[model samples]
Target chain A: MQLARKLAAKLVTGLVMIWVVATATFFLVLEMPGNPALAQEAADMQHGMSPAQAASATAVMFGFVPKQPLPDQYRHYLWQLLHFNLGVSIAEEGVPVSHIVASAAPWTVILASFGIIFSFLIGVTLGILTAIRRTTRLADGLTLLGAFINGVPVFVIAIMLVFVFATILAIFPQGGTVSVLETPGWNAGYLGSLVVHAVLPVACYTLAGLGAWQLTSKSSVITVLGDDFILAAELRGLRPLTLARYVARNAMLPLFTILAISFGLMFSGAVFIEEVFNYPGLGELLIASITTKDFPVLDGAFLLIIVAVILANILADLAYPLIDPRIRRS
Target chain B: MTRLARQPGPDPAGSAAAVEAAPDSVLAPDRGALGDGDAAVRVRDLTVSFPTADGPLPAVAGVSLDLARSHITGLVGESGSGKSTLALTLLNAVPPPGHVDGGSVTIEGVGDVLALHGADLRKMRGAEIGYVFQASQNSLNPLKPVGKQLLDLGRSHGERDQRVLLRRARALFDEMGMDAARVLASYQHELSGGMRQRVGIAFALLLNAHVVILDEPTTALDMLTQALVLEIIRKVHATRHLTTLVISHDVGVIGDLADRMAVMYAGRIVEEGPTVQVLAGPRHPYTRGLLTAMPRIAGDVSEARPLPGRPPDLASIPRQGCVFRPRCPLATRACAEAEPPVTVTGEHRFACFVAAQEVS
Candidate 1:
C-alpha cells in the first residue's frame, strides 16, 4: 500500500524534474549566441580562405538545418528524444552519441559499483562504531577523522593519492586501465591491472564519502537510543553488543534514503575520477562533449543521470514501507 | 489467631477492633523463612539525588523498605512522588544525572543487587527480578511478534524450548483474555491497549520472575482496561506466589492489588503499612488526605476533597529537611526544620513525626 503511494509521489517528483530540466536545456541551448557559426567564423579568421561554405556546413553540424524555425528545431529535438536517437557527435567525427556513451559506460559503471559497495561496507561499519562509542574519546577521534576526510573534496584527494602512489611510490601505474602491450582483454593479468588501476579512484570517492556516513550513523544511533523498541530489546536480556547492532541496523531505515542518493551520486564525480585514472567511461565522453559543445552527447549524458536519480529515489520510496512500520500502513 | 493492637480513637477502640478483625484467609498461620519477615529485600539508608539546573534534587531521600517474600508491597505517590525512583533503585537501572549515593538494594538468599554489575546484574534481571513499565508500549518491541519477544526474555536466564515457549505464551494469552495464536503472531502495534499490557506481563512472568517491580503498569490504559489488567495481576500473584512491587499514584488502584502499601510524598515514604490498615485508618496526614480525595463513585457524593495545596517544586527543597513539610497540613515549626526518620512497627512504617499523636 505504502509502496504504491511512494512510487506515485516519486514518479510525480521525477516527472516534474524531467520537465524543468528539459525546459532549461531547451532555453540554455537557445540562449547560446552562435553555435557552429561561431566556430566557422573563428576558423575563417584563423585561415585566409573565406570559409563561407563551412558556415552553412557548421550550421548543419549543430543539427540546425537551413532556415528552420525555432519551434521546428524544438520539435525535431523532441522527436529525436522519442526515438532515442542522440544525433551524431560533432567532435567525435560523426560517431553516434549512444555508441560513444555505451563504449565508455561499462568501465564507469564497474568503478562506481565497487566504490558504492565499498563505501557502504566500511563507511557504515565505522558509522556504527562511532555511534556505539558515542561521546567517548574513541568516538570523538573517529568523528574528527571522518569529518576531516569528508570535508576534503574528491578531486583533491584523488590527485593527492595519484601523487603518492604513481609519483612517489612508482609501484602502480600513473593512468589508464591496461598496459600498451596488453591492450583490452579478458586475460587475468589484464583484469588485475584494470582493478589495480581503478583502486585509488574508488578509494578516493569512498574515503571522501565516509564523513557523511559516520555522521548519519551517529545521529541514527542517538535516535534509536530513545526508541521504546530498543528498551524492549534490552529488557529481553539481549547481550549489550547484540543490542547495539540492533540499534545501528534499525536506525539505518532513514539512512537508506540517503544511501539511494549516494547511489545516484556514484557517477557524480565520475568525470573527475575517470580523468585521474584514464578509464574509458561516460565521464570522458561528457567532458569532451561539454568542451566541444557536442549537444547530442551532452543532453544524453545529463538526461541519463537525471533518470538514474529518479529511478534511485523511486526504489528508496518502495523500500521504506518494508523498513519502518509508521510508513507501512503509513 | 491473634489480631494486632489498635490505637484508641474518638469512634471507640472496641468498634474499630470489630472492623479490624482478619478474614478467614489469615486463620492458617503462614510458615517458611518469610513467616517471621526476614526481609527478602532490604533497602536501608538509600538517598538518590538527580542534578538539576540549580543543585541536586533528591529523588529517594533516605528511603528504606523491607520487602518480605510471599507478600505484595505497594509504593504509592502522586506524579512526582519518587515512588518510581524508589522502584528503580531496586533494579539499579537509574539513567544519567542520578545515582544511588547512600543505599544498598539487598535480597535475602541473594547478594546486594546494587553491588552486582555486568554479568551478575544481567543474570539477575528477567530471571529472579522482573520489571514491568507503566506503558506497555514501552515494554514490548514494536517490530517483533509477541512470541519472539517472550522467548527472548526467557533466553537470558534459562533455556526454553520452542514448545515450552509457545505453551507459556499461549497460557499467558489465555490468562490475559487474548487469542493465544493471534496475539503471539501479532506485532506490538497490532494489539489493542489491554492486549499489549497482557503481552508485557506475559513476557515478565514467562521466567516466573521472583521479584516483579511493576512501575504503574496501568497508567496508559483506559479505566476498563486498568481494572482488567489489575485483575489479571491479582490472579497471577496468588497463582505464582510472586513478590510484586506495584507502583501507582492512585491510592485506590494500589489498594486493589497491594497487600501492604507505602505512601511516598516528594521523595520520602510518608506512610506505609498493611493495605486495609493504611486505607481504612491512615496515620499520616498525607495518606489520610490522599484517601479523603478519592471520589466515592456510589456513596457520599460530597465526601471527596482535594488537597489544600500543590506539592513543592522538587529542585528548590533544602539539603536536609522533611520534603513534604512545605505542603504538609500538620507541619509544625519542628516539621519545617528537621526530617523525621521512618518509625516502624511490625510491617507498618510511617515517616510523619505527628503519626503517633494523630492515631492516638
Candidate 2:
C-alpha cells in the first residue's frame, strides 16, 4: 500500500514538472526577439515573390502561433499536451512534431544507454580492482588514465577520434548512422553498418563519463574496505571472491543514484556527440529545429527530455529499496 | 561445520557438566593449577610491532601467556595497551603496518598459527578459532540478511551440506535468545544493539570453532545489556567446552566473568594469576592501582584513587626500564635501570622488582 502511494506521489510530481516545463517553454519561445514570420516573409520576398505572395507564404509556413490571446494560446497548448498532441512543425512544413520526435528519440536513447551501461560496467569493475590493489603501480596508472580522459571535453575527444580513426587511418565510417547501400531491415549488413556508425559517438560518450565513475567508485570501495564489517568478513574466512562481492555490493549503493542522473544528462551530451557523428538522434533534431526556428518541434523535444529525466529518477527511487535492505525498513 | 564442535575439547565430561550448572561453577577454582602442556593455546614471547617514521616500534612487546583448556581468560588493560593486538595474534590477523614479528601462537590440535599463510591461515581462522571483534554489534554486512551472510560463510569454507550449517546457526541463535527465523531474515540495522551483539556471538560460534576470542564483548552496551552479554558469554563458553579469551578495559567485567585474569600495562603482561587470587592480592603496582581506581558502591567514594598519568601510545612508551615505573608510586632507582624480571609465587606471577624483594 505504501509502495503504491509513493509511486503515485512520484507520478503526480512528474506531471507537475511537465506542466511547468510546458508553460515556461510556451512563454520563453514567444518572448524571443525578432519575429520568425517577418524573417520568413523577407526570405520569401528575396526569392523574387511579390509582397502579398511573400506574406501569404510566410503565413502558411511559419504558423507556430495562431492568431489568439496569450492566455488562450497557453490553454490551447495545455489542452494539446493533455492529449499527447504536440502540433505540426513550422520548419518541416506539414510534419507532426510527435512524428519527428518519435523517429529521433530511439537513436539518442540507444546511443546514450549503451554508452552509459558500458562506461558504468567498465568503470565499476576497474574501480573495485584498483581499490583492492590501491598501492600497486598498475592501479596508479589507471587512476592517471581515468583523470586524463575525464579532463578532456567530449567534443574534443569525438573530434580527435574522427581525425585519427576516420580521417587518417580510414578504419571506420566518418559520419551517419548507416550506409545508404544497405536497406533499413533485419539484415546483418544494415545492423553492422548501424553499429559501425555509432562507434565514434558512443566512444566519446564512454570516455568522457568513464573517469568520474571510476574515481567515485574507487573512493567508495576504499571507504567500505575500512568498515568493521569487512574485517569481520575476513575473520569469518570468506573466500577472496566472496570478500570482493561484499565490498563491490556495498560500494555500488551510492553510485546507483549517480548512474541514474548520468542517464538523464547523457541527452545533454548527445547534442554535441550526435552532431559530431551526424547521427539523427533527438540531439540532432533539436539542433536542426533551433536553427530553423521550429518552435513547436523544439518545445516538444524539450518536454520529451524533461519527461525522460523524470522517469529515470522515478525508476531509481523505486529500485533503491531492492538493492539496499537498510532502506526497506525506513 | 558442525563437525568442528565434535572434536574433543580438553575434558569433555567436566565441560559437559559445567554446561548444565550455574555460571559461577563454570570455572573450577583449581583449573589454573593445570600444567602448561594442558593449555589449549600458548603464546611465547609474542612481539607485534608497527613501522613508524623512525623505525619499527613494538606495539605488543614480548608477552608470554597461556589459555587453559576450556577456560575463560580475561585480559584487562587501558586503550592502546595491546590487549586487542594480543588477541588478534592468535588468529594471525594483526592489522597491516603492525605484524607478529616474534613469538608463536600454538593451539593444541593445530601447529604454530603465525607460520600458516593463505588457505591454511584462513582455514584456521573461522574453522578452528572464532573471533568476536570489538564493537561486534556493528561488525555485520549491512547490505545482506544475517542468514545470507551465514550461507556465505558456509560456502567459503566448502561446507558440503548447507542445511547442516544453517541448522547449527539457527540453534546458536536460539541459544542466544533471538527469534531465529526473523533475525536470519533481517538485516543488521533491523536488530537492536543487544541482538546484534548476540548475532555477532552466533556468527563466531556458527562454524563450531573450539578456540573463541571475544574482544570487548560488552564495550558499547548499556549497564543492564552489558551484564546480560557477559552472562551470555559465560554460558556459551561453558556449554561449548571452548578455550575463550575476553579482552576488556573494565576491571569489574574481568573480575566478574574471567576464570583467569592477566593485567597488561603498556604492551607487556605485568601480572598473571587466577581471578580470585589476583583480585584478592594484586602484586603488580599497576594492577593494584587499577583496582584502586575502580569506583565501588560498598567502599568510601573518596577512597577510590585514580591512577596517575595517562596511558602511553606506541611512540610515547619508554624504551628502557619497566613500562609502568613512570606511573608507579613505589618507583625506585633500581626500577629505572632495567626491566623487571618475573617473580613466581604458587599460581600467580608478577613483574616487579620491589614486589619481588618484599616477598623474599
Candidate 3:
C-alpha cells in the first residue's frame, strides 16, 4: 500500500513536470524576437515562390489573425496535446510538428543509449582497477587521463575525433546517420553502413562522458573498500572473486542513481554532437527549429525531450528500491 | 604473607632489596609452566608499528603473551593501549601503515603466522583464528541478509553444500540464543546491537576457529546487552573448548569472563597473571590502578579513583626506561634509568622494578 502511494506520487510529479515544460516551451517559443510570418515567407521564397506570392500566402495562413493571450494560447496548445496533435510547423508551412519529432527522436535514442552504456562499462571497469591498485603507477596514469578527458568540452572532443577518424583517416563517414542512397533496413549492408556512420559521433559522446563514470565509480568503490564489512569479508578469507563481487555490488548503488539521471540528460545534451555530426536526431531538429523560428516544431521537440527525461527519472526511482532494499523501508 | 589487595600503594623502603635481586631470568622461568605443548597461541616479543610523518610509532611494543589451550584470556586496556593491534596480529591481518616490525605469533600445529603468505595466511585466518571487531554494527554487510552473509563465510572456507551451510548457520544462531529463521531473513539494520554482536560471534564460530579474538566485544553495548554478549562468549568458550582472547577496557567484564588477564599500557603488557591472582594481588602499579578504578556493586563509590595522566604517545615512548613510568605512582629514579626487568612470582608476570619487589 505504501509503495503504491509512493508510485502514485511519482506519477503525479512526472505529469506536472511535463505540463510545466509544455507551458514554458509554448510561451518561450512564441515570444522569440523574430516574426514567424516573415520567416515563413522568406522560407517559401527560397522554395521558388515569388516574394509577393510568399508574403500573400504567409498572410493568408496567419498574418490576418489576432494574437491570442498567453493563457488562451496555452489552453489551445494543451488541448491539441491531449488529442495527440502538435500542430503544424510555421517555418515548414505544411509539415506536422509531431511527424517531424517522431522521425528525429529514434535516431537520438539509439545513438545516445549505446554511447552512454558503452562509456559506463568502460569507465566502471577502469575505475575499479584504479581503485584496487591505487598505489601503482598504472592507476595514477589512468587517473590523470580521466581528469584530462573530463576537463575538455564535449564539442571539442567530438571535433578532435572527427578530425582524426573521418577527416584524416577517411575510414568512416564525415557526417550524417547513413549514406543518402542507402535504404533503412535490417539487412547487413544497410545496418553496416548505419553503424559505420554512427562510429565517430558515438565515440565522441562516449569519450566526452567516460571520465565522470570513472571518477564516480572509483570514489564509491574506495569508500566501500574502507567499510568494516569489507574488512570482515577479508577476515573470512573470501576468494578474490567473491570479495570483488561484494565490493562491486555495494559500490554500484550510488552509480545507479547517477546513471539514470545522466541517461535522461544525454538525450537533450546530444544536441551539440548531433549538430556537429549532421545526424537527423531530435536535438538537430530542435536546433534547426530554433534558427528558423519554427514555434510548433520547437514546442514539440522540447515536450518530447522533457517527457523522455521525466520517464527516465521515474524508472530510476522505481529501480532504486529493487537495487537497494534499504530504500524500500524508508 | 600480606595481600596487596588492601594495600593502597607499594611500600618504597622494603622494595629496595628485592628490586636489586630481580633479573630477566626470574621472568623466563614461567614459560615452562605452560609445558611447551599447552599454549594454543604463543606471541613472543611482538612489535607492531605504524609509519607517520615524524617516524615509526610503535603500537604494540615488544609484547609477549600466551593463550593456554581452552582458556578465555582477557586483554584489558584503555583505547590506544595496543590491545586491538595485538589481537589483529594473531591472524596476521594488521591494517597497513601498521605492519609487524618484529614478532612471531605461533599457533600450535599451524606454524608461524608472520612467515605465512597468501593462501597459507588466508587458511589460518578464519580457519584457525577468528576475529570479531569492536564495532559489531559495522562488521556486517548491510545489504546482505544474515543467513547469506553467514553462508558466504562458510562457502569461502570451502563449505560446498548450501544446505549444510544454512543448517550450520541456523544451528550456530540457535546456539548464540537468536531466532534463526527471523535473523536469517533480516539485514544488519533490522537487528539490535546485542543481536548483531551474537551474529558476529556466530560468523566467527562458523569456521570452527580454534582461537577466537573478540576485540572490545562489549564496548558500546548497554548493561543488559553487555551481559548477554559476555554470556555468549562464556558459553562459546565453554562449549567449543576454544582458546579465546577477549579485549576490552572494562575491568568488570574482563573480571567476570576471563580465566587469565593481561593489563596493557602504552603498547606493552604491564602485568599479566591468572585473573583471580591479578585481581586479588596485582603486582604492577598499572594493574593495581585499573583494579582500584573499577566500580564495584558494594564498594565506597566515592573511593573509586580514575587513573591519572593520559597514556604516553607511541612515537616518543621512553626508549630506555619503563613506558608506564610517567604515569606510574611508584616511579623512582631507578625506574627511569633503565628498562624494568620482568619479574615473575608463581604464575604472575609483570614488568616493574618497584612493584614486583614490593609484592615479593
Best by DockQ: 3
- Please state the Cα-based DockQ of model 1 relative to the true two-chain complex: 0.37
* Residue B149 shift from truth in candidate 2, angstroms: 2.0
- Clash pairs, candidate 3, are none
Q: Could you give candidate 2's per-residue lDDT for residues A1-330 as a string of tens digits? A: 999999999999988988898899888987767556667777878999998888777656744344457898788788888888898888778688999999998899889999999899888888877888898999999899888888988889989999999999988898898999999999999999999988888887888789888899999999999999998888889888999889888998999999987887666558888999999999999899888877888889998888878988999999999999888868
Tens digits of per-residue lDDT for model 3, B1-360: 111121222222112323454444454422312434457777777899999877888899888888887899999998889988898888888998789998678775576778888988887678777888764548887788888887777777888888988888889888888899999999888888888888888888887787799988997889988988889899988988889999989898898999999998888888888999999998889888888887777888878898898876776578778888888898999888987767777677888989766766
- The reply for model 2, stretches above 4 Å from the true place, is A41-63, A66-69, B1-34, B135-137
Q: What is the C-alpha RMSD of each candidate to the true structure, in Å?
A: 7.5, 5.7, 7.0
Per-candidate DockQ versus the true complex? 0.37, 0.60, 0.61
TM agreement with the true structure for every prediction: 0.85, 0.91, 0.91
Error (Å) of candidate 3 at residue A225 is: 0.6
Better of 1 and 2 by lDDT: 2
Candidate 1 contains a number of clashing pairs equal to 0
True contacts kept of 1: 0.32
Candidate scoring better on DockQ of 1 and 3: 3
**lDDT of model 3, residue B150:** 79
Shift of residue A184 alpha carbon in model 1, Å: 2.2
Each model's fraction of native contacts: 0.32, 0.72, 0.51
Better DockQ candidate (1, 2): 2
